[model samples]
Target chain A: MSEPDGGTVGKAMTVLDQVANFGRPVRFSELLKDSDFPKATLFRLVQTLTQQRLLTYDNQAQTYLPGLRLVQLAHAAWAQSSLATVAAPYLDELAHKFGEAVHLAQLENGQVLFIDKRQSVYRFDTLAQTGQVAPAYCTGVGKAILAFMAPMERDHALRQQAFVGYTPTTHGAPDSLLQELDAIRASGVAYDREEHERGIISIAAPIMSDDTNVLGAVSIATSTSRHTIESLDRFEAVLRSTAAQIGSAARVWRAPMPANPSYGNSGGENS
Target chain B: MSEPDGGTVGKAMTVLDQVANFGRPVRFSELLKDSDFPKATLFRLVQTLTQQRLLTYDNQAQTYLPGLRLVQLAHAAWAQSSLATVAAPYLDELAHKFGEAVHLAQLENGQVLFIDKRQSVYRFDTLAQTGQVAPAYCTGVGKAILAFMAPMERDHALRQQAFVGYTPTTHGAPDSLLQELDAIRASGVAYDREEHERGIISIAAPIMSDDTNVLGAVSIATSTSRHTIESLDRFEAVLRSTAAQIGSAARVWRAPMPANPSYGNSGGENS
Candidate 1:
């Protein structure tokens, strides 16, 4: 809550984030305890957000939760800005063909933000829900996207990584992770190897535009109980093809825009 | 373009809404054309929003679209505040059982806001996407929720209705809709009868808590080519039971809150 630099808008967004982070309908007092804003400022910010329908105040519960207006705005974001909508049919095809969960993700704020997922009907619980975030260093989709980024952009993103090891196989340092990225760049695929979670592993490929710009990544994820690391390699060819198809489709959809040298290829900055 | 009531936060939100309404990545010039703010004011606001990641500036396109942060916040809102997550399993069941699309919606600002939808594998094109808003006076889910609302609350919602006929079967006045609501109340369900969209009809039931609080509504929608108004009645019993099951499950999930008399039954105010 160090005052974000965008003035009143930033403060208001910070307040919105505070409420969302509570992850439940929360009391004003609870928000106050955690907020960096003064009591009066916090109150005014909350009131403004509620009035604008950015946060909904639950009367009976005497609590506030993220509002429906966010969902409305987010729908536009997902449909317009994200590759999720463009990749949906491909994800569905891959998921159905393999009968495993598939994830579509983009680098956001130097992290892996899962924008969409297709869970098979035979759903085994996997932690990757749409909109969930994970460390870029340890996840398959994240590494795949990172591996394909321009060197400068990749370096910037790597600088932001904490590289906390979540499992024995997790990357413990930027150097170690960079080595794997070099391999992924050569092979055109990345693997999770139960790095982010104990049992879950995935095979992932970076989706690249026809011009070789990194768009995002898609992954086919499963449990160690279901498949060994060697067995996961069986999906490599189909996964890469699906990624290519989505990338081609997305490029067509985005063809109207003039290309700027500064965007898309920069791993997560301004994403 | 009128300045909204909540000051800077309001103005900022208005800008955000403007971006979302564009429904595509749009240039600053395009946004300026539609904006009411002075050029300097608009520039500052846009810059602020972009910095906060409430809107993402597409450098390559030189345009802006709603941002990934909104998607993350929206995911929490959908999971925590919306009935979508609660009704998901039931929506899946109903959609599979009938091989028709099932919609979950809540009234927001006197309009029907679809929070979730389950489309059958045999997907026929329908206008109802998640986060899509429709008139409350005519749609099945809208009418069903209105039928169960407390009288004063229902009246408040009715006054907000424009009552423009979308089809020949659409309700044209409060009196006509009130008459239908009475029947729906008596019958414990509502039918669309191609009122909102020709050839598309639905059977809907209000999801109520054990205390009879209207949580929201669920509708199973289909085309006239698939089902007649009388034939739609075949789903009435199962639809009502599904709504009841969802209501029970949601109530349990929400049981931590103290009962407030003024909320949940108010149709759309503060929703």
Candidate 2:
């Protein structure tokens, strides 16, 4: 919270996330509104991050966003992170079995970075913007992974977090969220319960790493209008089984699937 | 080719490829053998890149590879490069229809970047290593795209190029490569013919931007033992139609897939 050295890199990272999280190139004013940073600080952060190739700018549009450098970096990290590949078959299977959208995302700085997504053939508004960020407390996949974090860390995250109530029921309290996470950890499943958006529910479970760190979470997102909670419970079983299978796969040969997971200080790979 | 500043970025990128292409972290000595640079200068470059987070260093192993920052960069690039997302449904349809590996790659700086890939349900070797680079003259997808390049640029890429003859059947002659491109252009399809590998055969078509610039190429790779040219042709109609579908998507979207169609690219999202 204190900065005089400019925290050049951290500031740049902040600007990058704002854009990366925006799901599209963001205008400078949009940056200020989203990050709640001072206008001048946001400007310098954008400019420097752009100069570093950590962020790229489209001059004509006067917008800022993550640059090619991040793609290059993500590719390299993916080789080390095996979640992307490990979850592919499972996500594919989930998509096929459920005829709905399946996705894998990691909690980064308290938001979801969708690493990979599979669309349903059924054609629904379930289309997710891969690499887009959403509040960690509202989505099943995010809560599933967050449930595994240390109690202290989870509390800290909840305290400092700014959550948007996409619907009327987005989770907000540390105590209540703790209960949800405990349920996920105990039963090996997490549910959206129409919290993230109206008329949508997702069932999710965490995929672990070799050391049993929650590396990321996988989920099936569908419409609440289409699938009732009882049917969703059945699909939750499927989602949990799929996540477990991916965990075993990740530990076996460590193929490059690259889903960002909450590793419980296992390199802090998660939030 | 020369000293420090001349090929600074190239050598650094080569080290990146060595790690990325192999799907594992590479040792310093192994990297030394893979590149032709003085040890001292290589050390500096690696350190600088690591410092910049363009690359990473594993302290325990003393090996250098791409860092999470690079993955972030790649992800950021994909965030902006909408080509992959736009083309994904088409790749999905192609994979579902053909039940083979589908890859979308772009030529970048005389190499290829495998921006996006989807595999069949059955087992197969991986076709994409997201950021790795390889030769352009000998790959089906490579030639298919190169065939669309401006003549002068294409000729320039071929100059002083050693075709390496991945197989004896590889077209090493500049004349033959030019000839093949012509046929591909005429026929609207390009063939690999076991040029890149003995057991693999592929056919590719280009996805062009609204400006008619070749944004990237897509290919279907299958085993020579199981898939004959005729069999591949059986799927050709769908493949070409799928490619055109992706092309149209790219044009309508104006934003290229969330990936740069880099040169001689290999592997997908496998940092």
Candidate 3:
């Protein structure tokens, strides 16, 4: 995940991410073992990052985790990002109405990053945790976003997918996934029928700006024991509407766009 | 706010923060006006930051904002910080029971940075937004944490306060605030009597680990129109218990230790 860009700043960030990727606080030696950077460089980077309060070091455990500074910055990011703050009330309403788990996800680094989640009142352990990442080839939210992308961007995003089969229903090749994407474009919906996980299923729709920009995706998830895939069909209209609401809201509430529009842009470039 | 430490890395972060402080997408010229760095230096910093994904540039608006990477890092921080994740269930219960806004906060750079918030069903525009920063001398969560800190640490923290009164009841000096802190330590809670905002009042309690370490604070905030200061007292027992539960949970699920403990150590150093 560490791409050597932006010189010293890039290196420092790589070290910072390594620690964060662990989720649990990590010791220096543990980081050293996993990092591609040399020991001296890694140590210096860690030291500087700690001094900057970008990485907090715990004395007792002798490990490092993300610092409070990151948390503070993230607050700003959430406000700017369309998926979390902009869609908060809508997600709340969706969860309240359906009485099932609801999730909002955005494409980050060509992978499906679950930005926010609302746990169902009747909880069963579902693998989709907030900030958890998954393959774009199998999951409902992932397919929803992939379906609406411009062909070139869609192909680029598709190439990045691992295409690992998680279950019998999972897409294992690019051609099969492309076929599904074509179908999703026509239907304006994507479904996961035990594709990502056994007994878990969800119906998803892509959130798009008025100009057809792929903002993100929203999904209503439940276990098969509680609800079948057909039962999830009842939520299609609601999911699409919720996604549209978020997309329009995102259009009004714009965030800073990237300098390189070819990679990730607000508007659908190919369209 | 920029101390100019860590050379290039520090300057880069300072530039990043100035953009974030705007709380909206900001142009390069606008950033230049507020930044301590020279124009060329500032430009370079922004470019490097954008490349690193620490800051995002909007090609359409030609502005900058916090990037998705920060959001990614923040997800890790939220889980690791313990205040938010460890206290999630408690916060949900508190908000559900009182049907009032619940805030969880931690001290950062002498300011109170809200880590998480549970909005009551009834929505009203109270000043506190999640991940928002507020003056430590005036807010309930701020004072609650301050009151429990060691005397020496308290004085250091107090020195950092601007003490600019936002309302008539806001603490104007260290002596008066110290008196309130003493009262809080004795009563096991702190109150904001429309101190930070004209109509906002909250009852808060410090979350502590063992006998001394002040982890953070939790508050039940409501508009004065909803309830009087005396009426807020009814929440004292519940707030204290909630704070205790979070503190205990935090102790069990600790994050990593710092390399240098003196600056921001875990222990209540004075004790």
- Index of the highest-TM-score prediction: 1
DockQ values of all predictions: 0.61, 0.23, 0.47
Tens-digit lDDT string for candidate 2 (A113-187): 677788767677753555566678888888987888766666766665566667778876666777777887888
lDDT of 2 by residue, B197-242 (tens): 7888888887766444677789988888788877788877887777
- Judged by DockQ relative to the true structure, which candidate is superior, 1 or 2? 1
Better of 1 and 3 by DockQ: 1
The superposed Cα distance between candidate 2 and the true structure at residue A238, in angstroms, equals 5.0
| Every candidate's lDDT | 0.87, 0.69, 0.84
Q: Single out the weakest 10-residue window by summed lDDT for candidate 1 chain B.
A: B262-271
Best by lDDT: 1
Please give, for residues B228-269, the per-residue lDDT of candidate 1 as tens digits.
999999999999999999999998888866655445544354
The worst-scoring run of ten residues by lDDT in candidate 3 chain B lies at: B262-271
Candidate 1 has what TM-score? 0.93
Better of 2 and 3 by TM-score: 3
The TM-score of predicted model 3 comes to 0.90
Write candidate 3's Cα lDDT for B1-271 as tens digits: 4464756787788888888888888889999998777999888889898877778776666778888888778778778886788898999999999999999999987899898888867787677766678889999999999998988888888999999989898888899999988898899989999998898899999999878789899999999889998999989999899899999988876633445544544553110
Candidate 1: regions farther than 4 A off: A1-3, A210-212, A257-271, B1-3, B210-212, B257-271
TM-score of chain B of 2: 0.79
